[model samples]
Structures are given as C-alpha cells and as structure tokens.
Target: MRMSELSRRSGVSVPTIKYYLREGLLPAGRQLSATQAEYDENHLRRLRLIRALIGVRGLSVSTTREVLGALAEDTADTHRLLGLTLGAIQVAGETEPDSPEPAEVDALIEKLGWNVHGSAPARATLAETLASLRTLGSPLDWRVLLPYARLAEQTAVLDLDQLEGIEDPLEVAERALLLTVLLEPALMALRRMAQENESARRHADGTAD
Candidate 1:
C-alpha cells in the first residue's frame, strides 16, 4: 500500500507515520519509486502496536521505541520477553520512594510463592501502594488479600492458557501488553461493584450507609 493507503488503513495520519519512520518507531516501507514506498500487513500490525503503546498506555515515544525494540528481538522464552517488556515500560533510575509496607508486602509475596524477581518494578509498586493506603487511613490487612491473590493466580492460569496456542512472537507480545494495560481498570471496576454489593449484604441494617 502507498503512504495514503497505509495511513487510511492504520488510522494514523501520514505525517505521523512519516515521523514514526524517521524516529525509528516504524521501519520504512519498501521503496517502490523515487517518491513511493509500499507498506504491508506487518507494517500495519506494528502501527497498531505503536498506537496501543502511545495512545492507550500513554508511553512516551522513546519508551515505545524501546519496547518495540525488545519485542523485535528473538526470544523463545515468553517469561524473559515479558520481563524485558516490563523493564522497558517502567520508569527507570528513580531512588526507591520511602514506604513503610515493604516488609509486609515482601512477606505476602513470599507466602504466595510468586516467581517474580526481587528487583521487579511491581514489588516496589506494591509496597508503595500499601504505604499509601495506610497514609490515607484505610490500611488493609495483608491476610485479607490472600483470596485476591488466589483469584489473580487463577486469572493468570487462564491468561497463560489463552496464550498457549499463539506461536507468533509479535502476536504474543501485543496480546500480553494489551491484557495488562487495558483490563486493569475493568477489573478494578468489577471489584468496586462487588464491594458495594457485599457491603449492602453484610450491613443490612436500615441505618447502614
């Protein structure tokens, strides 16, 4: 397809596509003539992934470029590829923010036997979130999250099952990123509704707010 066709098909502006090409986010299409280049389905797929990273996930252009680079590398191991992706997406070089819940979070993770690396960004995020909850005066018992962790484990199993049939590396990477970035808010919304329903059931008195 020509530039115009590529733009129309990918729903990206021609100028924006050219910018991506210049920035090395999207590889240049095949040269057909002095002024023409042809794009194929792979280009289209890459464009979609770029849009998802920048538009949906709100990653800066440089970060998106890094992620695409990681995805492009040949890696037969999905776990290692995912680790690379997470590392690329996470903000880097920040001193660890002081958090009071690191020990509790570490203990909970240990009890659950999660296979995450000690330096995983999610470990720091969990600790910071727990600390924030306490600072907000809504501290929760770590034991209360055991069931939630079990639910997450089941969901992870389902996710891995879905990925089992996918043989294409790019497809696997894009699907995993989409699931993590897009489904998080949907999951939180469902939890909120469930909490409302449970609160109503458990506190049935007329005076209950």
Candidate 2:
C-alpha cells in the first residue's frame, strides 16, 4: 500500500509515520519508484504495536525503543524484558513541592533493608512518594505494601499462565502488550466490586448490632 493507504489503515498520520521511520521505530518501506514507497502487513502490525507501547502504555520513546529491541531479539527473554518495562512504569508514590531530600531516601532504603543499586531514578521515585505520603498525613511503611505486592505477584503469574504455549513470538509480544495495557483497569474494577460487596456485608452486620 502507498503512504496514504497505510495512514488510513493504521490510523497514523503520514508525517507521524515518517517521523517513526526516521526515528527507527518503524522500518522504511520499499522504494517502488522515484517518489513513491510501498508498505506491507508487517509495517502495519509494527505501527500498531508502536502506538500501543507509546499511547496506551505511556512509555517514553527511549524506553519504548528498549522494549521494542527486546521484542525483536531472537533470543530475548520475555520475562526479564517485561520486568524491566514494568519497572520503568512503576509508580513509586507521589511527590510534594517540599518533598524529602535524597539523603532521607538513602536513610529510608537502609531502614527498609532494601538493597537497591546505588542512587537511581527508582530510588528517587520512592523518596518522592514517601514524602508525598507524609505530606498527606498517610501512614507510609514498607509493611503496608506487602499485601499489594503479593497480589501483584499473583496477577503476574496469572497473566503468564494465560500466555503459556504461545509459540509465535510476534503473537506472544502482541498479547503481552495488550495484557499490560488492559489488565490494570480490569483489576481496578474487580477491586471496586469486591469493596462494594464487603461494605454491604459490614453494613448488614452493623444493623444486627
């Protein structure tokens, strides 16, 4: 297909597609003539994957590049690549204007017995979140996150189980991308439903009191 057809099919603008081609996110099309090029199904699939990574996953260009590289590797370890991608998107907490100092973060890492690599963005994110929690007068403790972490681990296992026996690498990668993009909202809604049921049970018990 020509550029205009590709633009219509992929729902990506021509200039944006050109930018992606230039940035090496999307591969260059075949030169059919002096001023015309042609794209194929592979290009269409790649463009959609790039859109999902950037638009739905909210990954920065550099991070998305790293992820795409992993996906492209013949011997790439999917689990490890997913871990790194998730780490990049992890929300440590929130930050306040008068947030705690980096030194305080160092101290907290020590206090929590966390053996993090020396001074990284992850550490900074944690520090900022802790500071924000404090500013909001919320109880901030490592123990509080334990249950949530356990649930997250279980969910990861569930996601992997769902993906088991996918021999096709491209299909596996696409499924993984879609799962990550869609699962959070699904989990959140499930939690809300559970909360409502529990609240109803509590109200019934209170009425009996």
Using Cα atoms with residue i matched to residue i, what is each candidate's TM-score against the true structure? Answer: 0.85, 0.66
Q: How close is candidate 1 to the true structure, as a TM-score?
A: 0.85
Residue-level lDDT tens digits of model 2 in 32-138: 99989999988887888788778888878887777777667642676655555455565555455565545566665565555566635567686776676776788
CA RMSD of each candidate after superposition: 3.3, 5.4
Please write out the lDDT profile of model 1 over residues 1-209, one tens digit for every residue. 88899899989999999999999999989999999999998898888878878887789999898888877774587887777755557653322456557777677888899887888877677777777778789987778778888999998897677778887666776777787788888889999988888887788653444
Question: Candidate 1 — which pairs collide?
Answer: none
True-structure Cα RMSD, model 2: 5.4
User: Which number leads on lDDT?
Assistant: 1
Error of 1 at 138 (Å): 4.6
What is the C-alpha local distance difference test score of each model?
0.79, 0.73
